[model samples]
Target: MDPVDYVFTVRTGDRKNAGTDANVKVILHGDGGRKTDKMKLRNILKNDFERSQIDNFTVKKQFKIRNIEKLELWRDNFGLGSAWYLDYVKVRRKDKDTEYSFPVFRWIPAKTHLIFRVNDTSLPQQDPEAEQRWNELKRKRDSYIVCQKITGGPAQVIKLYCSTSLKGQVPKRK
Candidate 1:
């Protein structure tokens, strides 16, 4: 979470044509290249998915997710035919002493505390619908503090929770 080197936007809106939209919070914690993480975030966000935690009610400063989206990491350069992208995500929920998978995209992070946000752009190529959703996400998003390490040059390792949220949905993949 080093001031967010990058972000992936997943948005929606109140527009009649906006269709069905969901916002899921995904916890992306693991060691890999930037490409892997980015690709996962985008694919999952645009897919049907969910992230459920084991009801460990941690105090989150009195906030609620009006919308939840499971944002998997994705790549900036979706080159070739190797896009693993998001297929399906399942939220693990339990009731009556039984665990169930909810087909919701409020994807929770593997670990708690770490945070991220969807990338934003004002370029003309950006989708109009996505822009609107991004707007809504920014209007009602939340953040948390996590001890994450942002690696760079050997002596320039940065540490902090560069956490934020996205405000849109992924355009149908091209």
Candidate 2:
């Protein structure tokens, strides 16, 4: 078997697909998250190296993004406790332009995963997306792709999971 190497992936709460809508948002560090942010990343990278997966690993990483918005906290109290939303937008438009006023729900500061890929050299950048690396990372962040822990022997097979939701469905609605 080839020596294993780790690929870091920053996963979001929303599941991923080629057409999945990754509720992307700018993540402002929370009270505790800010403190351990560096530690968590450090451990994640170190664990791989300790395991001897590859000769050398990387530190900086990011994923593709379809969209993103700065988050503003929204407070709602229902019975037991209050809830905060970081992914929502208030919009105003001219009636002549068919203005619709509503709070658009969004996802921001998403759950991230350190996805690993094994390779002998750095990953190649496709010609088409070379110019839009930041956007691509946003897309990748929106879609949290978690690697399942393989408890058994070698993974003999691989599977692809896609969603059936009509709203985020890809292919561009006409």
Candidate 3:
């Protein structure tokens, strides 16, 4: 396989304490079972992954991964303020004009791993990875339960509740 270059742009959320000092890594997954080894994201000269910052990283691999499907990202719980708030990631192959965007507007706790799939609006049944789709749906179904608080009332899905203190810590929308 010919070596290919890929550029990854990571955006940090513009919220209080949204940056992290821990080491971050990523793995790119593509079609036909193609994947890349975990690569570290770092900038030695300047502090990276700061709040509201967009950092770019270049990765060169011998294998040319076609049609990127997902990105696996994680951070090592090292140093102070390890939690991070990721806004999104954009990836583009050097020779390709098309760019892939993965939106992940959420907080990543210390030492946590998360998978961000491409923004394909396909239904679960239409997903190519049947096992993954099934597992994801099953997990969601198990985590949320339907309950009726009042008689003859509509049922609501009950999932994990956020603590008031935690909610207060979140920044209010402008």
Candidate 4:
């Protein structure tokens, strides 16, 4: 199913810090113009609040994607206190039940955005150049096997040589 909207869930580690109060920006880029969503987090909880005394503070935002190829999430701290300790960012969709969780077990500085590529499994088939290259590589591999086995050698020695020498020659998949 096509994605209609994205729901982002973010949580801060420290409850006592003002890091939870933030302005987050989400940008979705696709064939059309980029779509932006601004999220606001208010300072309801003060610095004296204990972490275990209450539930963790989390912020959620839902933006309409319509159609997107990739997206970026950013926290615009605008010169605040210490960097925010991010636990994670989860992306969900309205049409699909699948949810993608991006684990960010680190501190997020101001003005930094995390970019993600949308994995569209239903992408249109491209030119046959990639297929042709694969076929050629397969034929070359079979020839290499035949030629190597034609000469008698220890199985373990041949295996070691072939494995090490072919490491750099493998093709990368797109």
Candidate 5:
């Protein structure tokens, strides 16, 4: 299962004492269309409830999910008396052209998963050397194919195969 990581930034209202005290939960839908529950991602406003000055508060959080095909985010207000604002979610995949941004004028749905399409231009690009290597591998399309989440870091190590027919075989990393 491939693991995907995401970072979300959010803020609440300007009211000093009115914000969420509940935890935000993220649901991951993986291959075969299965949903897996992840740990609650705590909100900054909730953590610092006492020191909050309430001037357009904002907070950032990072979470990871393995075998993620799609994901849904939810937060239960439980009559917390205030609505939370989701600014945006940043995904590591380069195949997405834009980050997920929430609308400022409307209230977001209580239950929904944000969906995004992977575009060609959004795929991540490594350094010059890595780019050159990738191009070389791509040229031999019949012989090699690169898979996602090969490895994490500035220089990503994509899983590849010597040939398309060679399943269950991991080509040596150059």
Candidate 6:
């Protein structure tokens, strides 16, 4: 197979201490269980993974990856202040004009591995990954609890848990 070029655009969250100096790696998973070896993301010309920054990186793959399904991203946690807040990651195949976006709006602590599925909405019952779907639903239910704000009124929702790094940083409602 001819070598293919994949462009990865990583967007860092625009929050205090959201950047990290640790080395980051990614693995692309495609249909039929095809996957690429872990590839390091780096750009020597300028500092990467800074807060509110978009960094582009290219990786050459010897095999073709069709229909990217999931992305595995992690950091080596090798540098000071290694915790990172990632907004999202977009991947594009230059030759095929194919693109996939993974929405990962969360903080990734040191030595954490995050697997993001392609940005596709599906019912939990129809989701292919049973474990992932269950866990996600459970987490959301635990974090966003339902309560009755008034008697004989519609139930109100509230988020009971917030990350320590995001406390007092969330934008106020307009």
TM-score of 2: 0.17
Compose the digit string of candidate 1's lDDT tens values, residues 60-105: 2222222222323322222222212222232221212222122212
Better of 1 and 4 by lDDT: 4
Which scores better on TM-score, 3 or 4?
3
TM-score for each candidate, following the candidate numbering: 0.17, 0.17, 0.69, 0.40, 0.34, 0.70
How many pairs in model 3 have backbone atoms within 3 A of each other, for residues 3 or more apart or on separate chains, i.e. clashes? Answer: 0
Count clashes in each candidate, considering only residues at least 3 apart in sequence or on different chains.
40, 25, 0, 0, 4, 0
Write model 6 residue lDDT over 1-174, tens digit each, in one string: 566788999999999999999999988899999888888899987889999999999987645687899998889777787879999999988897778999888777556566788995567687666686566567666676555544566765567654343355442221
lDDT of 3 at 8: 89
Error of 6 at 134 (Å): 7.9
Candidate with best TM-score: 6
Per-model root-mean-square deviation over C-alphas:
21.5, 22.1, 7.4, 14.0, 21.0, 7.0
Model 5 lDDT, residue 173, Cα: 43
- Candidate 5 per-residue C-alpha lDDT over 61-174 given as tens digits, one digit per residue, 9 for 90 to 100: 323333444445566654454345443333332223334443221223334333322221233363323553355446445444344334442433442442444466454443
lDDT of 4 by residue, 1-174 (tens): 232545555555654453533455556554566554554433365441122222222334444455555556566654445446665555566566666555544455467666544542222245223453355456445534322322353322223335555454442221
The numbered model that scores best in lDDT is: 6
Question: For residues 51-84, could you state the per-residue lDDT of candidate 2 as single tens digits?
Answer: 1122222222222111212112222222221122
Where does model 6 exceed 4 Å of error?
120-174
lDDT score of model 5?
A: 0.41
In model 2, which range of ten residues has the least summed lDDT? 48-57
Give the C-alpha miss distance for residue 122 in model 5, angstroms.
18
Residue lDDT tens for model 3, 2-37: 878889899999999999888999888999889888
User: Global CA lDDT of candidate 4, please?
Assistant: 0.47
Clashes of 4: 0
TM-score of 4: 0.40
